[model samples]
Target: MNEHDFLLMFSCLPTSNKNEWLNLKTFVDIYNSKHDTNYILKSFPENDNRTSPEPEILLCDGDAKMVIERKVFAFPPSYIRDHQLWHEFHNTFLRQVADIFSDNLYELQIKDVDIPTNKKEIIALAKEIASTVIEYKQEIKNSEGIYSDDLIPWSFFQLSDLEREDSPIDCGVCVRLKISSHFYNNQQLNDSLPMIEAQLIKLLKASAPKFDNYSDCLRILILEPHTKVLNLSINFLSQVIQSIEIPSSIDQVWLATQFERDDEELIRDYYLVVSNL
Candidate 1:
């Protein structure tokens, strides 16, 4: 398999750095803690080319008894598409200027919504960014260590030196660009209800059949969010799941994501969607 495909599919394997691995691990940890069981990773049946409709992950207490089918859902699809295009631009830009910005930690915050889609435009924009970085490298390296510049196709761009004392983590890199959108609320989440329910039902339909072979096992469907904004509420999610039809073979469906507690600490948390118990 190719590197991308392997990384995407085998994320449930032990010690994998992929977010899916984190989702699965978090679910397992929560499950073990809640149930007081010693279930551990058993195997990845989906990787077996010989099998049909295989489970993404299988967990065991003593013998194989639980099956996990994972699906990543994104809302308003455009966000993920734009985010990907940004990464494409990032790669081209980094390749063009990696030598110039060597060994300095930086974060490029962009407020560009109209991101380029085509390869030609992406490459051209990357060049533009490379030039911009070059033009401000001296000022960027100054003691203050922050620069804001405007460019075509982007209204605002800010570069910050992450090596400062207030930096979140010490990324020992020349520069790093982080893309994120933290604008979302319960009202917006409610507005996307129909689309969310439709997409989730489609996923259940696809994954449910895979559990036919594992009827004796505790079947679980994990829906992980791929979009930047999926501020899911337990009450809202419970209502959505109640309106849908989960397959009989699947005993549970869980929405797993990073949860911020009342204490402002972020932890992996799961909310039950469909529970036969």
Candidate 2:
């Protein structure tokens, strides 16, 4: 089932004492029953023991194999931070299982935490995380495909093609545009450039004479994707492009359009073309 269905199913399940151990046990029981699979759930060993416990849940097809860990909690900002106990437990478990599972093992962190208020928000987050995990797993499965290929060399798009020698722009703008082009071509959807533009405009409008360096502007932009800003007029994108002194070349314009289209393979092909040029 999809993430939303999973969440809804989880919500329908009976609530327990809300204790971590108890909640985990309930999940294990429900999951096994629902899937009609033999999944054995075991508690982690105490700190005094030299051997780390096997993962929380083991799914067996023939022998016990797949491992999953459950972390249930109210939403806390520091839940995944390095210093947090949950984070420590997660890292430790991965390290312990590194050799035991060898190649066939999979790790899943199922969290029943408070999600954002938006509709299907939890599902959206879950899907994004799951997609990332699937991508990583696929990469690992195709080890030959990875090691057989040489790394592509980093190359820059030609600014000379812009045909405007006396363009009034900061050197940082050129650098960022080149980097953006590189990422866009490689099918990397980095939401930082537009974000930075918004922040830069805010700061510029606030303090007329004060100038911020490129890195400072970029740092603000890279904070998060501007979902709110996306709903604004097309003029917003134009303003950002103009502020960055981006090239007016037809190729550059077409590349930007490809980014808007969000076709992954096409973007990658564009990147190849730009790199070759």
Candidate 3:
């Protein structure tokens, strides 16, 4: 489906209050009303004593089978200081959900909500949240294995400072951009975008592909504040592409471009701008 169509099927959950939940529900409902697919909410059973349900949102497919969870927040400082708490709450909730549903239940998905802030602390907070969600989801996979259809896949999304326009560049954003760049590209030089994309695809094949071509999958979206950092990441990606040798079947690289609009532009530029060895 198209981006709008995909978004409609994807759910948003904010673990804050009724207003936020209603806001997200309203958005999904509006979007789905235009599309043919179905969207529904799956509330945590009230009797089930969990972490107060955290007030998150879920988006399901036509069959009410596929699901996506959305988590929204304000800034990085809040997330950074309470990173551990977020993880505990999220993990506890997921495990409890798994327990409630058992192995026979349908798949569930998790996604972090996007916040518009450019503070370094806020950007860092978003990255931390993204990393935590990835880690937590990985742990679940390790414990449950891919065969267990009951497992819920998780992803993250955060709005970048670029979206805010009025925000300043934070040291945290620079650090995270640099680190993520190095982590993905440093190991594989000489790797084509298609190849690197392929490997990432393989990594998430059973669960959620880092980038979902289809809207059914929940994704982590990050918005970048500065083009310079985006350029740096592309350079880093170029290095990664050059360093590694990969097969041909891979078509695209799947990265969380939630906040890096400039990077998205550069990805398009890669077609014309050949790497200068």
Candidate 4:
């Protein structure tokens, strides 16, 4: 909690500008004085690819760290935690996407242990997914309906998973998907391009200040965003990285989500980091 102690711990921020660094340091120093223990508050911008909730503040000391991301959602109507609702939403969107892409396999081999595995194959698959994402994004943008969450879910195949599956027919490797609301039925897509631009603008403004210090990283973990919006969010962050007033302050920008695996217990929830950036 001592100013001298904190100065010794973090030796870089002050190098940028005395006034600015002092402001940030003094803020934490005051926080430390309030509590009995000395503390190093990392707004946790998630150092070293660490995965957890976006912490408001983290108390880090040696190997012992306490995360303060606690919240009490007193019976909120809009806070969606019900897995069934999400599953239903995702399933509906998947079915719609399936109907659209049924005839447009684009040469992707549906046979077991098949499809592209090389870099070219990977690029081909990415392009296919990108195209689909754009279509769904457009559909959502053009809809006249309201949304608490307007993003649509997208499903696709992973070459590695598809190839490793012994029973490709029911392996479920080809259908990585999410769910969304039922507001996108036969919606006319008006001003799709404008919508994309506006969304990108929103993302950049929201993400810019997340990294305050030059060493801080910007890593956002989304709960249930539209599949297309996820792609767009990453792309938008990348596009604005260089344009920001002090871009170097942000070392990296990551968009990650929770995933399941064989060793899920060890990590509680593993995050799969992804970014168009």
The TM-scores, one per candidate, come to 0.73, 0.20, 0.23, 0.24
Q: In candidate 2, which residue ranges exceed 4 Å CA deviation?
A: 1-20, 42-54, 57-62, 72-277
For candidate 1, write residues 1-277 as lDDT tens digits. Answer: 2221111111111233233444487788889899898878877777754458877778899864888878766565564566566668777776866666555555554545545667678778777767776677777666444444544433212235433555554442233434345545768776788888988788889998889899879999887655544244444555787789888988998876554567755555676767985
Q: Compared with the true structure, what per-residue lDDT tens digits does model 3 show for residues 44-123? A: 22223344422134446754532222222212214333443334444544443434233232232232332223345444
Which run of 10 residues does model 2 get worst, by summed lDDT? Answer: 268-277
Which candidate gets the maximum TM-score versus the true structure?
1
Whole-model Cα lDDT of every candidate shown, in order: 0.64, 0.29, 0.33, 0.33
- Model 2 has an lDDT value of 0.29
Each candidate: RMSD: 7.7, 28.3, 21.0, 19.9
* Position 20, candidate 3: lDDT: 37
lDDT of 4 at 128: 55
Q: What lDDT tens digits, residue by residue, belong to model 4 across residues 156-247?
A: 43234345544334322134322233222213222233453355445445444443432222222221122322222333333333343323
For residue 157, give model 1's deviation from the true position in Å.
Answer: 9.5
Q: Per-residue error at 177 for model 4, in Å?
A: 16
**In model 2, what is the error at residue 252, expressed in angstroms?**
40
